[model samples]
Structure formats: structure tokens, C-alpha cells
Target: MDEQIITGATAAEITASVRTLHERGALRPGDALPPVRELAALLGVNRNTAVAAYRLLAQAGVVVARGRAGTVIAGHEAVAQEGYAPDSVLRDIGTGNPDPRLIPDPTTALARATGRPVLYGEPVIDPALEDRALAWVRDDLPGRDLRITVTSGAVDAVERLLAQALLRDDAVALEDPCFLASIHTVRLGGYRAVPVPVDSEGMTVDGLRAALDDGVRAIICTPRAQNPTGATLSPRRAADLRALLAEHPYVLVIEDDHFSMLSQRPYETLIGPEHRRFALVRSVSKFLGPDMCLAIAATDPETAERLALRLSPGTTWVSHLLQRLVLAQLTDGTVLHAIAAAGRHYAERNAAFAAHLTERGLPTEAEDGLNLWVALPVAAKTVAERLVLRGWLARTGDEFVLSERSAPSHHLRLTVHDLTDEETARLIDDLAESTR
Candidate 1:
């Protein structure tokens, strides 16, 4: 790593030089960057200018700061996402997906989804869908300055909301044992994640207060049916969080209610009536199927305006057909009944499985989500390894943790709602054996 390769008079120029050097193979990943003072002296610039240059590069995902180790070149790595293993023979019980059998058939709604052709300059959201969504969303988010915007899904909406409000390197408070997509999005965007611990009552008050004290610009919370852990926010817990957040009135709050329709628990929120900034996102993927690729965001007027800037008029807006399809299914009597039945089915299956674990001396509770978070007597990694040997693939709770200082997770998140009675019994037996 020759200091001579880095030559520039200004911060932008220095950033460009490093990018060019990396492109030309002169600089590689893990290469050390010169310290701020040394680089400043070499370029005859102030130390602040040198620091700014490095910050720019870090924001671009081209470099990472390592404190005493100084700055180093960084390489992009593919993030793990939620889905089935492409060609694996093992039964995957870890993928956080809805049961396909429970998802209502979309074919019947396709014809109803068809309508008059929409032009480029027309409104982005379908009139019918918007009308239905407003009524439905209003029930949950009552009495606030609200506006509805659509995106590909809950993940897309969160990304857009963060992009609209945050700068690179800004801190965002995320739930520990977070949703996979949130972890991936924060890492890729080059933003810092502050871990806020979640218990049976969702985000803890002290954890959120700490994140706020750390000067997080934003917070992403799952109010109901939190992923991986299946934690829901109790009314008292929500009130405590809202009271704490009231002090930092301007910190943006984004609540993701991904299991809106399928959740058996009541919906509780972190946003206060007088809170200045927020977004509440609900996606149809859970009940309508993932391929539908549509979600509605109810956000503050200013936030909605800022988010709209990222979505171009004609090309980037969510498809009208998808919105119509969701609206049709939502309004249909038969589809609503089916969705309600599916919710009960998931609760019943998880309870049965939890009882099985309890009978075997491993105390467990059936939480209110599609997955069961099981605590093993031993390390979850040991059990996962044993499960793999027995033709079962499970996701360990360690993958969702935000900080290394947190205790080693002895938990596994299992999606076993779709499993038959015989299959469930076999899995319970295998889990018991694995712990031994």
C-alpha cells in the first residue's frame, strides 16, 4: 500500500482516486489506508479534509474504519436472505415463509383485477385499492396525519423510508435477533445498527433509551409478531416506548406490521399522537402470497413526500394490477374467512408443538407468529448440526443477533405450521434426541 498511489487536493478528488485505484486492481480488499494526519500532511491539506475523504469512501462501501487499525479497503459480500434452499434434499423448517396451502388462490381475483388501462401520468395507486386500504389502515392507525404510498413489499418500503431520512453512517436502532432483511438492508446501505433488545413484550424501554442516548437518527420496530422471536408489544410496553420516544420527537420511527392480517394478537404501536415523524408499513405477502409484491405504507405527510421523490412517476410505481388483486381478495367474503382460518391454524399447530416440547422437559410457549422460537437445553448450533444429520434444516437464533456481546443464543426459529401431525411428532422426537 503505497501512499503515493493516493493523490488528491480535495475530499471528492481523494475519494475518486481511491475508487479508481480499486477499479484498476492497484488497491485490494483489506489493504490499509493511511491515517488521517499522515494523509493530510502528505497532501498539504487539513486533517478534517482527509477524514472527510475517508468518510465518503466508507459511505460508498469502498472502505471501513477500524479505529486503531485505521481505515481499510472493503469488499462487498452477498447477504443471506429468507427462502428455501435451491436444491437441497433436506426438509427446510427455517425458511420464514407463509404456508402455500393457506394462501388464497389468486386466479379467481385476476379477472376482477383487470380494469381500464392506466396512463403514465395517472395516479400511482389504483382508486379502488386506495379506498379500501385507507378504511382498513385507519382502523389500526387512528387519528393522525396519514398518507398511503405503495412499494414492492415491506422490505422495499423500509429501505425507501430510511433512504429518505438518513445519511450514510447514521445510526438506526434495530431489534436484536432482527429480521434478516432489515439486517441486510442496514449493512448494505453502510449505516450503523444499534441493537435494542426485545423480550416477550417487544422492544425494551431501557434498550430504546440507550439507542436514543447513542443518537440514533431512526428506529425500526416490529410492533406485532416480531420475526425470529415471535415477540409482540404489550399495550403497557408500547406506552412506555412511546413515552420515551416523545422526548426525541424528531427521530424517525418505522413500524413494520408484516403479519397484519394473520396475527392473532391485537395490534399495538410505538408512535404517539403528537410524534413528529413515523411510518407504519403493512404488506400483503403474508396472506395474499409473496409473489403479489405489494405493500401499503401509512406515513406522515412530509415523510410520504420525501419517499415519493425516490419512486419515479411512470416506471418505479407499484403495478396497478397487483394492487387491484390485493383489494379484490381483501374484500371477498370467502377469502377473508380463509385468512381467518389460517390464523387459527398457525396458532393451534404452534401450541401443539410447544406442548410436545414441554412434555419432554423443555419448557416452551406458543408465540403469536408463523414461527416458533424454541430454547434448547444446549447450544442451538449443536442441535442444528444434529438436525442436519437427521435430514432437517433449522435456522439458529445466532444468525439474527446484532452484537457479539449478547449471550450465545441457544434458540432455533422453526416454521412448522405446514407440517402434518406425524411429521411434527417425528421432528419433536428428533429435537429431543439432538439435545442429548
Candidate 2:
């Protein structure tokens, strides 16, 4: 065991020591530290000091406390990120955004939105748009009791949902290596985020149950193309999660299927057929363009009514014009075709990049969605530094971490697959060089 991880006389120092080691790649995920008694002896502190340090780390989702197994870094939890430097000379592979070039041109849709102005006291939802939203969302929702509510975007719907269902400091379960926007929303809303680790098969049952046991009032999940990780919940995993959640049926479950039309993955759901208090949100941002700013939120009636209170009168109904534009685009054959083509483009390019990396012994696979989640042998921060020297800007794994901000992560969620074959090859070689 590394003795230096236990040097601090104070609780904060002990925790910070482990953080420093993890950040610079000295400590690794799932690696165990000394036992509490051993750590206390090494630091010449009270046993409570070691216990407090480990408790703090565990609370932050940085470490797990297993009886007899000691404390180990918590792995596979998700979080959000920051963008690349604005004026950098490097080719940025860091931005997690969908390429604007692929966003369907909305000029045609906007111009074709011939709907008349909407007035107050008019039905909150435009009759035609609501019908369209209902049709588009109904198949994915498991229950007939689901109602439609429109929000500016998926983020808006999420914020409204949590605001309606939870009080300040209420615990909310979030996927580890989580969606950045959800993390931001949860924090800004003053709710507590309990990180639930997500694997390739999607959110781990153990993580969700663990959070639920902690009395989390709400859960926000991405059923497909999970942000940063590109994890799509498998059918079996979805079923298992649903079964576990069945015991806690009234806890609010919100599914943000952000990549609906553009996603290649199957629509597996955790809002089981009988599960009450659920919301399924699908946004048009990834396909129709972020400028569209339209999303259809399907939820149980009570949740919908609570969410609707926030969207009343003139305060915040989605613009009638924007709604019509989204409808026009969704209905237009050409626009739908463009969205399909863009989806194929993202998958193919990501697959190509993943394949090249694997050939070079990096062992990557572009499973789904826009970005390729690439694992590196070296710490991601170290690899990112080398990429910067080589004129490439990549997002380090730490950028998306929620609690364990400096965990020694060896992955990069890169959106650089649009690079030329030569550029991809050179970048892969540079990555290997940096690790070596």
C-alpha cells in the first residue's frame, strides 16, 4: 500500500492527499487504500480522523466503503463538463456538442410555418403540434395515463420536473459520469446529487438501489446515448432496474432520451408499465437543431399538472412559432431524411475512429451516438497535455466528474471522429506516444 495517502493530521488533509494522488495518476480507480486503523497509525491521528476522511470521500462518491475490503475509489459514476478554450490554435476534439453542420437546416421549416399567432386563453398546446407530440412520444411511454407537456427544451422540462416533485436538499439519483446539464440543473436547484454508476449496459442496478436506499426523491436517466459515456441501457438491464424500482413506484422517474430520432439504439425503458410518477422526455435539439428549442415531455397526469403550473399564461409557454417550425420539420420528408443521414454519418465516423484506435492497440469501440468514449492506458490529463502539444484539444475524463473531481481516469470522450483518416491515425499514434 502507498503510505503517503494517509499523512494528513486533519480530515480535510487526508482526503485532499488521496485526491492529489488520484488527480496526477498515482492512484487508480477501485484501488484500495490502507485500513482505518492503519491509516490512523500512519498519520499519528485519532482513528476518528481516518474514519472522517473516508466518510467525506465516500459521501462525495469518490470512494466506496466495503466492510473488510477497506475504502476504494468509486468507479463508473458520471458527470458533466466545460468547453474548450475559445481562441486556442489547436483543433478541438473536446466539445461534446453535436456538429452544427449536421443540424437540419430550419430555414425551410420556419418559412413554412404558416400557423397563425396564438392568443392567451387559447389551448396551451397548439392542437396540431400537441397531436404530433403525442403520436411521436406515446409509443415509447409504457402507460396510457401519460400526458403531454411542452417545454423549451429537455433541460427546461427536467428543471420543471424536479422543481415540482422535490424540495430543496432533496436527494436526486444521477448517473455517474452524468449528463452535464442535469448535474448543473440539480446543483442550481439546490438538490443533492447522489451519483449512480453507469456501465455500457447503462445505469447499474446496485447504484440506483443504493441511492434509493438513501431516500432519493427523484431520478434522472438517459435511456440511450447517455451523455459523455455513450451508454445505451440494455433490455435486461432496463428490466432489472425496473423490477428494483417497482418496490419504490412513487419516486419520480424522468427519462431524458435526448437522441431520439438520431439514435441507433433500441428504446428500452425503466418507467415500467405500472410504475407511477414518471416522465419521458424527447428533445429535437440533436436532430432538428438546438435552435429549434422544442421538446415533448410525457408524464403521468399529476406530474404534468404540476409541471404545467410553471408554464402558465404568458410566463413560459413555448413559442407557437417555434412549435410549428418543429412540427413542420418533423413532418417534412426531406428534413427527416437529412436527420437520418446525419445519424449514419455520426455512427460511421465514430466507428472508423474507434477501429483505427483498436488497430493501434488502444482497444476502443464507438458503440453509439456522436462521440467515441476512448479509454487510454495513461491518465487522461496526461494524455490531454500531450495532445495539446501536438495541436489537438481533447476533453479529459476529469472534466465530467461530479464528486471525485480528480479521480485518476484513463478515458477521453472525444468528438474528433470527423477528422480526416490521416489526422485520426496521427492522433492515435500521438496518444500511444504520450502513454509510453
Best of the candidates, TM-score: 1
Least well predicted 10-residue stretch by lDDT in candidate 2: 76-85
What is the C-alpha lDDT profile of model 2 across 1-436, one tens digit per residue?
Answer: 5686556889999988888787877777888888898889888999999899987776665676655767787566444444556888998887767777888777887787876777886767777888898888787774477789989999999999999998665789999887779988887675778989989999999999899999999999999999888999999999999999999999999999999888988899999888889999999988876767888899999998898889886768998888888888889999889899888889888888888788888899787777888898889989888888998898876766665654588889898746777888788888778867
Task: State the C-alpha lDDT per candidate.
Answer: 0.91, 0.84
Cα lDDT tens digits, model 1, 153-205, are 99999999999998888899999989999999998888889999999999999
TM-score of every model versus the real structure = 0.95, 0.80
Give every collision pair in model 2.
77-176, 77-177, 78-176, 78-177, 78-178, 79-177, 79-178, 80-180
Candidate 1 is scored at a TM of 0.95
Leading candidate by lDDT = 1
In candidate 1, stretches whose alpha carbon ends up further than 4 angstroms from where it belongs are 2-4, 35-45, 66-70
